[model samples]
Target: MKDLIFDNFQNAVDESLLRHKSILDIITKLQESEGRINRAVAKSVTNCGCIRVDAKKQELPKEDDDIEQLSNALKTHIEGKLCDSCREVIEHEIGNNLFYLTSLCNALDLNLYDIFIKEYDKINTLGRYTLR
Candidate 1:
């Protein structure tokens, strides 16, 4: 019975990992497309009565290192047991990030609302409870 329970637990973990991997793949594609879309919008906006505003892009110390660093930081925070203040900060930051993403999608002519609804539907179909 112990072995059976362990196998079931392992299977659940594997399934969750696969789902995460699939989501990552989708996000990667979206990120790649964002660059192209941004360039195209930059070109087209000049004649479309839209103001072309250029903001200075911030450069990181190490390019493409943010994800790993963030993952490590989050792991450390979780392992160390996050304080209420830290949790609040994290939650706020997540909201900020989501807002930024939605703004970017709008600027890029992407239907963020539709995309969000589709993803939400997928999650809803997975037998998870969501606040209405």
Candidate 2:
């Protein structure tokens, strides 16, 4: 109903989170949401057969290769795109995950945007080393 802005969504989650106010509840719900997301993705590959995971050992680059080279050589192991049904299910599960994540941040008096910015800065600072 509202804009998908981070702070706005965080505030909305804070406002709507009436039942799971306790930190413990929020944490468990968050974990559950994560599990659901995993299940949804699994179903897409296993049941729906919309996508596939050709999971195998990552073909590591040469020892002397640059970080950029290593990054370029990496593979996600996921082949094929998610179908509309699978995408919708996964998106909904991820939305639930975000809801509880925002709830945890709210309970701890932390700003979701601040967390994002801090992580963004860390990644930017450690562009080459962050992989490790």
**Winning model by lDDT:** 2
lDDT tens digits, residues 52-127, model 2?
Answer: 9998888889999998889888889899999999999999999999999999999999988888888889999988
Task: List model 1 lDDT by residue over 48-116, tens digit each.
Answer: 323344445433345556554543433211122334544454465554444445444543556655676
lDDT of each: 0.47, 0.92
User: In model 2, what lDDT does residue 75 have?
Assistant: 88
Q: Which regions of candidate 1 deviate over 4 angstroms?
A: 1-81, 125-132
Error of 1 at 76 (Å): 12
User: Best candidate, TM-score-wise?
Assistant: 2
How far out, in Å, is residue 78 in model 1?
4.3
